[model samples]
Target: MSSLKTKEEGKVTQREILGCLKNCLLLLSD
Candidate 1:
């Protein structure tokens, strides 16, 4: 159960990081 929770958390963090990276790229392109 703990491992599953950790994996979910990691995925959430990764998604957030990807979103931030995409925003940065958009700003740079503009």
Candidate 2:
């Protein structure tokens, strides 16, 4: 159960990092 929770949290953090990277790229392109 703890492992599952940690995996979920990692996924969420990965998604957030990806999103932030996308936003940064967009700003650079502009």
Candidate 3:
């Protein structure tokens, strides 16, 4: 159960990072 939770946390962090990166790129492009 702990391992599953850890994996989910990692996925969420990765998604957050990706979202932030996308927003940064959009701002730079504008």
Candidate 4:
């Protein structure tokens, strides 16, 4: 159960990182 929770957290963090990267790219393109 604890492992599952950690895995979910990792996924969320990865998603957040991807979102930040996307925003940065958009700013650069502009």
TM-score for each candidate, following the candidate numbering: 0.86, 0.90, 0.85, 0.85
Residue 3 displacement (Å), model 3: 1.3
Model 1 spans > 4 angstroms off: none
Checking candidate 1 for backbone clashes, the offending pairs are none
Q: What are the per-model numbers of colliding residue pairs?
A: 0, 0, 0, 0
Q: Whole-model lDDT for model 1 versus the true structure?
A: 1.00
Q: Which whole-number lDDT from 0 to 100 does residue 21 have in model 4? A: 100
C-alpha RMSD of candidate 1: 0.6
Candidate RMSDs in Å, in order, are 0.6, 0.5, 0.6, 0.6
Please identify model 3 stretches exceeding 4 Å from their true place.
none
lDDT of 2 by residue, 1-30 (tens): 999999999999999999999999999999
lDDT tens readout by residue for model 3, 1-30:
999999999999999999999999999999
- Using TM-score as the measure, the top candidate is 2
lDDT tens digits, residues 1-30, model 1?
Answer: 999999999999999999999999999999
Q: Model 4, 2-30: lDDT tens per residue?
A: 99999999999999999999999999999
lDDT of each: 1.00, 1.00, 1.00, 1.00
- Where does candidate 4 stray beyond 4 Å? none
Worst 10 residues of 4 by lDDT: 1-10
